[model samples]
Target: MNAINSQKKHVFFRRVSTAGQDIITQEAADLPFREKLSDDEILIINEIATSANKKAIKERPEMQRLISLVKDKKVHSIYAFDRSRLFRDFYEGMEFNDLRAKYDVQVIYTSVGNGNMPASDDVFVEGLLSMFSDIEGKNIARRSREARLRYPAKKFGYQKQKETKRFLHDSSKSKGVQQYFAALKEISSLDDLYKVTKEYRKKLKKTDEQLVSMATDPFYAGYDLEKGTNKLQHVTPYISIEEFLQLQRVNGEFFKAFLERKKSLMCQNIYTPCCGYCRKPLFYKIEEESNSSYYSCSSKLHPKVTVSFSDLSKIIGGILSEIIQNFNAEKLINQSINCYRTIKKHLEAEMDSIDQNLNGIIEELVLGSDDYSADWKQDPMYKRKQLLKQEYHNCLEQIKENQNALQKNKSVIKVIEEALINQSNMNPSMLCDMLINGIWIYGDNLQVDVFYFDYLQEMEKEMIFEGEDIA
Candidate 1:
């Protein structure tokens, strides 16, 4: 026994999913006879690494440490209960083979092929076994995903029955669920619903997303995945499927209108301008009853100031009127030409730089090491190539936007001149949209920024240049 133990050295690597402590212990105890080795051949019982609930070999820290031992020539052989217990992917099998060849180490399985060494036939069999394991793992994942989409038995208001695997509503939880649906039906507006939710939130401790899911998920109305429809009569439902659908339709319309109004009121080209004092964009507010909107300073640290839509429109109109009345066609034309030239130069330089970076990445990808094919999916060079491609597309989009803006700027004077010809036809909203870019309000004072095409182009170029420098 002493001679055999001294001549043969081995390390036991055990891994299992949950509730595997007993299985691992039993395997370790039976290792000597199972692998035909003496009991003294066990290198270190205390040092045996066990990873629980880690299905992937690469994701397991303990397994990585064990692999490091093999790399450092600290272990002669690795013993596991079976090959499936060691790896669930073919790539992992290839990696293990590479490690074995590189470090002159061996892996022996107690149950698989009754412990075989690395040879042509053994390698082929191992590859086949790994493929089977990978397929089995994928099948299990697909089954789990399908089960979720089909059953989705576990829910907030219901408990799953152990014996039957059926869902039944808990009386205590069902009451809250019923009350929540009742409130949804009773509320006339989103504001009222929010207020009711706040009261319920004290006890429910549900997040906004969970509350939304509760309101929208068809399960509450007794959804059957097999039929892909709500079977309200099939199971005892808290709310009728018809009522649930009606609520969704109504709320969905309300949400859509709310978003549209928000977009219009907070339009970046017209609304987003810094406060004169605080240099921060004003926060928007709407009075539901009056339908009057106002933009006010948001900072609590700064003195409060509010400006109505009417006042802002008047201020911006006066500024546009002045610019139109004091029109300078030749000066504006020269300015536009100069700005276009500068922008063209900067854009061409940026495009050239992006092209160089992209070519470098492509060159590295083509001339990468022999193992690049195996590792390229996770390689840094591949990630850089994807990022550079995205950046190149973004630059192209910016160039397009800048050219369109230049054309719009050249036509601004014509638009304003025509509006001034018929002074009565000049609408505040129309004028604001046509000429004004943004308006800033400070106490009683207002700052109106009229969009001169040349100035806008130069600002955009500077912004893009600064962003590129930062990147």
Candidate 2:
């Protein structure tokens, strides 16, 4: 389409499902409409070999171009052979109509395709036919998809026979795939599985999650879960159903081991996120020779900044013990109580704003409503009213939740205060994250930064809620 923004354009758009078909006859019938239009004002949109049932309007190349013209307000009118040439579904018709409405464009259908079904003049009749066409097109698409259920495309580690169309194992990848499955027995953690993944999955590049999903997929076991015993999918099992079950057991064991090894380290992940010197994330690793856990930076640095887990535990324990001995628990409890009370006040003010806004929209909807119309439910105002009611209910739910939190906060504060008094009860694992900001080990000096505080305003968010109860 030639988009001369200053000038109006009349578009003649045509589509055919296959390369064997053409819009010559339709073009001849539409030629009369073009005679009245100037050369600059005419835009011919021809979509060849494009299936409306297979592809949507946006997916079709020529149709997308025509839509762009309409959206830009460069189109004055659209001419087609028939409605089916433009729309095979009701949604397509509705969308095309909406675009025309927005850009002040007109539409004209010359005639029906082959006249098996005639084009109607009445708006009501056209609407009924459009709905039927939409359902029929969807039914045809479903049938087409079902007809090609046994497409020759084969999965990984297999190939489809060209002559017989039967799936057979490719000797090359099948051996590697089988090896990967066998290696599952040795996998104790995600690390072991990932190393094996790097070795075997040279050709198959996939994310960690995708590899896990593919490992569990039943298709590799030579059967579909939906297909009963009478029918297995046309694929040879490189890994037998029995072997697949064994591998799943191994995978489950690996998951358990991974979770078991993960421990709560006070300054590992959050507070001491990275090595202060190297600026690399720190992770926990066991020294194989000594079998001692150490928090070390991932990056290898000169004069490595690392700390032993046992040393870390003692350092954090000492800090918390000293804080507990000197800390004023009564002042903290009083401040926390006042904070919750202030939060409740803000929540109440927010609820009031939501109510006032909802009420104004409800009044406007009631005033502008067409009482006699049967399609009042379909109105934009009616939809907005429903949305406002939902928003109001959500705010009310939040306010009620805050009320419950206010009561729970008191008991939680009391329990936390009691835990601090008895230093033995205060687990450094729970309190250290809130108390310390960062820790850096350099040469012989171990440095710790205490978390800064806004004494008047801030509170550590639900440390009691997250950690185990000490009450």
Candidate 3:
């Protein structure tokens, strides 16, 4: 075959379970497949250390490279001593079929290998092997889970293995053992000693959290295998048995609280709803009159009822965002002052006009002219006089209100100034809270309204212009 064509080389594939299983020996054993293929063909060997589970293949670098080679059409076919050597699981077997159909890579099994089952029985044999592999994997997981049941009862300690003939600890160096015992004497109880040890850990920048973690871990206990009873040759203990048990109790309570918090955070009800103005999670409320349950945001139920979920309220919210973008604090204050002066001038002019009209009405009344009482009921002059007086007073009130709002808004500028000068080391979750009020699910489409759109837009613009590497 080598003499026939250099490009058409047969590839020999082999695998081993562990480093102890030599690849060369396995290749020599599968010589029949080599003989069947051309002598000119290249050989590719891949060793998988772990059980050839789906996760293993997906993560294995060699298997990934093999797939890449097949995709590139570099290999005409794949040869293995047995299908299990390729993959013990059926999913992987089907993946092999997909490679063959898609890339024209034929699979060859040596007749001498256990993987050399007849071609007719390949389907059934592979399926059975996969089922057995899955069952084995599941059993291993179950056993590992069960072994952890002893964790609460067991304490951390070192035991010399008979085969290795080594003691786990020695207080010989720097009289370290004597020093630890001396320090332990100062503590009134084990708990006090534990606290003192924790303080020492902090000087080393360690935490009680790390200590608690070691208590639950089974690795330091000397077993070579977690799921199986493969005890290693030797082990050493680091902490006292009493301390380890105490650590476990504290850790168990901490973990239980941590899990409960995780569950509640995952639940959707604690989150804000789109129709509320509070931007905070709604609290349940009862309507005493109707005995009906209702949920309302904190802002709506509180003083002044500043926000609502009504259409007009939503429109006002949108307008406020736009106004915040367009009107900076200093500029708004100047504009408001100018507007107030103009309004005051207009009101003064109207007052002047109303005074002239009142003089005319007084003169008519003094003359006792033309049935004045009847004229009051039917005359446009009387109505105009009353309307002008009300308008003047309303204008003055509006100008005063605008001036006050302007002053308050000016005060708000100090907060903005402080924030703008400060560094933004914001947490991601906190940033999310500041932006998203709540999303409204309308049929298939979602309506997302941001409470801080103006600020977000300003930040985004700054980020884009900063020319930082996005990656």
Choose the strongest candidate by lDDT: 2
Q: Predict model 2's lDDT versus the native.
A: 0.67
Q: Report the Cα lDDT for residue 400, model 3.
A: 78
User: What tens digits encode model 2's per-residue C-alpha lDDT throughout 1-471?
Assistant: 565656768889888887899779879978988898888888888888888888877788788888888887788888888777888878787667666767877777777456634544445666777777788778877766543443425466778888877778788777777776677667776778757665665645554445565577666776554345322467677677777777777686654443344423323432353577775656766532233577777565556767777666666566566555555555666776687678767777877887787788778877766674668778786787788678767867876787787667767767866776564344566677767777676544456666655332333322221113211
Residue ranges of candidate 2 with Cα displaced over 4 Å:
12-39, 44-68, 79-92, 101-104, 108-111, 115-149, 152-154, 181-207, 216-218, 224-234, 239-471
Q: Which sections of candidate 3 miss by over 4 Å?
A: 1-9, 17-21, 36-39, 48-51, 54-58, 88-90, 101-104, 111-125, 137-167, 170-210, 218-247, 255-471
Candidate 2 Cα deviation (angstroms), residue 9 = 1.9
Evaluated with TM-score, which candidate comes out highest?
Answer: 1
TM-score of each: 0.44, 0.43, 0.41
CA lDDT of every candidate: 0.64, 0.67, 0.50
| Local distance difference test, candidate 3 | 0.50
In the range 104-131, model 3's lDDT, one tens digit per residue, is 6677665444534532235566566556
Ranking by lDDT: 2, 1, 3
